[model samples]
Target chain A: MFEATQLNRRNETTQKLFRLALGGMTGILILPVILILGTLIWKGAPVISFEFLFTGPTKGMTAGGIFPALLGTILLVLVALLASVPLGVAAAIYLSEYAPNNWFTRAINLAIINLAGVPSIVHALFGVGAFVIFFKFGTSILAASLTLAIMTLPVVIVATRESLQAVPEAFREACWNMGATRWQTIRRVVLPNAVTGILTGVILEVSRTAGETAPIMFTGAAFFLPLLPQSVFDQTMALSLHLFVVSTQVPNMPEQLPYGVALVLISLVLLMNSLSIALRMYLRGKKKW
Target chain B: MTAMAPIPGRSTERSLAIRTSKLNLWYGTFQALFDVDLDIRQGIITSMIGPSGCGKSTFLRSVNRINERLGYVRTTGTIDVMGQNIMDPEVELVQVRKQIGMVFQRPNPLPISIRDNVLFGHRIHNAGKRDARSEEDGIVENALQTVLLWDKVKDKLDKKATALSLEEQQKLCIARLLPVKPGVLLMDEPCSALDPKGTEAVEELIWELRGEYTILIVTHNMAQARRASEECIFMLMGKVVEHDDTGQMFVTPKHKETADYIEGRYG
Candidate 1:
């Protein structure tokens, strides 16, 4: 009995040690995220002002503001969402609801996974090949938006499919037993329950599309377009590309200009993410079962 | 074959609501039901009783084509509902479903308001037609009233159907089907998820719905079958062993197998 008690004490100590190690590892994992956000806010907050946000850049991309870039980022994300949301959601619906469990469906699932894994630079080259040159859209917002849409389609499809699957099969069976067609069931039952998850995907796509510089650079983004884009066909200055240009390409640029642009871009993405999270919380509270 | 004509009072062939001739079903390579032939009457409660894995639920599902949702499920048979062959290629599924409503082992109310749940079937069947608000209210009230649930839930019509007690949810499920005016109701162990009180309440409600709709219920509880059903079917190994009037079958089971099963000798 004494030996058993001693063994139990040793096991307890070992378990406690393992728990502490796991906790420390978690802290280490989160440290970089905390440090990055802290440094960015500390360095970038003071540079952001209404004047800096609202006016156009001046003095050879050295001073004034990044309004054109901000507007271009917004436009790019909007058009990207417009192109991708419908296509992605439709594809996800087909994948989750209509597709039979066979090799063809498996191949489609594999393709989505591989598409998500492909490097951003490779996507940029493909975008240049397909959207910029092959389709003859030229270096314009439309081409960039299309490129970004394709790149983010996998994310939206996966997220939407997961949410669609999360809805209980019982619900679908119940609706079907009531003589509802597949489309009717999806429209009235499935889609409403899955909307919050789909919106979360769109929000993630917004953040990703807003931050990408490589694909948009060759497709439509200009190094320093002083004028805002008036149409889909016009080239525009993007925040990601502008930040790149201001920090590296332009000589003797203002010390805080790139920080301000970074701050705005980060803020935009964070704001979108926060809004989607709040919406998801509200929807969850309203969920009946 | 002596067990085939166990029910003495009612003629088996007359006024049939549903008839399955040489019914066979398979999930991929494995067969779940084999050569099932049953003549369910037009307006009575018939209960199917069997041990687990005996394909009673599968048989219930096949009546309304609900089993076809699974990709590998295949059925070769003629299920005629109200003298129309549901297996025919030209028969639209929505029409078949419109004529028949099903309740699952677990009560599945849509995650919507109680009022909307009642209107769902009517709205689906009558897609292009619009009803006045008062008309819809009447439909909801009448259906809920029929299920004996309106008095309990009348004040909270807009509340989520899922928020109700399990017994209420099950009753609401039965009530929702009434607005569609279906001729037959298929129930697959509808009381399996409820407590004793819930089961009793739902059983009483099912008994109340006896004459209006032909209810074919599958139950494991022998007592429920004896109390609520006019006729009872005993199945084992995916084959119907005996079917007869509930009183006669319980008092004088024709087959030795039926006697053993009812006497709790073996599953």
Candidate 2:
């Protein structure tokens, strides 16, 4: 009986040790994120003002504001989403819902994986070759947005496929048994259920597209634009590229300007991620079966 | 138990509701069913009893072409439902599904409200044809009432169907199919996930639906088969070993294998 009690005590101690190890690891992982956000807010909070957000930059991008850049980033994200969401979702539906288990499907899956792994700089070069030069869209917002869209297509496809597959197969079967066609099953039951996951993917893509400087740099973003882009064909200043320029290329730039840009970019991403998370929670609450 | 008379509205012509001729199925290289020939009559409850992996569920799925969803599955032979050969190249899947409804081992209602769930199939089948708001309300009421779920859910038709107990969810699954007006219902171990009370409640509801729809139920429960089905089919090793009236099959099975299974000597 004494030995049994001793063994139980040993098990409890080991369990507590395991829990502590896991908690410690979590804290270690989150430390960098907290430090980064804390540093950005401390350095950049005073520079963020309403006029700074809504006016064009002045004095060689050293003083005035980043409104054109901010608007350009939003436009870039919107156009990329418009280009990729429909195509990516359609491809995902084909892969998850209709693709036969054959070598062809396997090849498509491999292509998607490889496309995702390709570097952002390589995608920018491809955009220049294909969209800017070949298609004559020129070094413009359309070309840059197309490059970003292609780069992010795999993310959307992967997420959409996972969520579509996550929908219980039984739901499809039930709908089909009631004489609903395959498309109808997807439209009425599968898509509605998977919408939350799909939206999360799109939102994540928004943050990713917003912060990417490499793909948009050579393809569309200008070092400094006096006025905002008026059309898809126009080159525009973007927040990420603007931060890069002000921090590295410009001489004697205000110290807080780059920090403020970084702060806004990160905050926009965080806000979108939070919205996706909230939507997921709401949808999960509504899900039955 | 005494023999129950055939329910009213049953086809007096004694026609077959479902007919399978030399039906065989395989999942890739693994054969799950072999030469399953069955002629299920219209408007009666027929139960299929077998041990696990005996191809009872496989047979039911084949009738509705649900097995084709698997990429490697291959089926040969013909399935005729309501005089139309479903295996024919020209027969649309939508039409076949409209004629047959299915309930699963577990209830699977959409994440939508209960009323929407009931009207889902009807809306799909009648796409582009607008129904008056009141007519839709009536359709929803009639289907739920037939499943005997209207009273419990009437006050909150807008509530999500998943919030209900398992038994109610199962009933809602059945109610949802009714609005589509399927002539046959395929039940694959419908009560396997339910408690005894839920099973009894669902079984009673199935009995209530007897006169209007033909039902083919696959169950592991021999007692359920004997009590609920008017006719019974016993299968072993993916082959039908016996098909007879429920009373006859339970009292005096013709084959030794059937007798052993009924007498609890073997699965």
Worst 10 residues of 2 chain B by lDDT: B1-10
lDDT of 1 by residue, B105-143 (tens): 889999999999999999987873759999999999999
DockQ (model 2, Cα): 0.65
Model 2 Cα lDDT, one tens digit per residue, B5-109? 223366777877888889889989988888989999888899999888999999998888877777788999888887777888776767767767899999988
- On residues A1-289, what C-alpha lDDT tens digit does candidate 2 reach at each position? 3466877989999999999999999999999999998989999989999988988888888898889998899899889999999999999999998888799999999999899999999999999999999999999999999999999999999999999999988788778788777788888789988988898789878888999999999899999877778899999999899989989999989889889989988887788789778888898777665
Q: What is the TM-score of each candidate against the true structure?
A: 0.94, 0.92
Give DockQ for candidates 1 onward, in order: 0.76, 0.65
> Quick one: best TM-score, which candidate?
1
Best DockQ goes to which candidate? 1
Clashing pairs in 2: none
Badly placed stretches (over 4 Å) of model 2 are: A1-26, A275-288, B1-8, B128-130
Evaluate residue B230 in candidate 1 and report its C-alpha lDDT on the 0 to 100 scale. Answer: 97
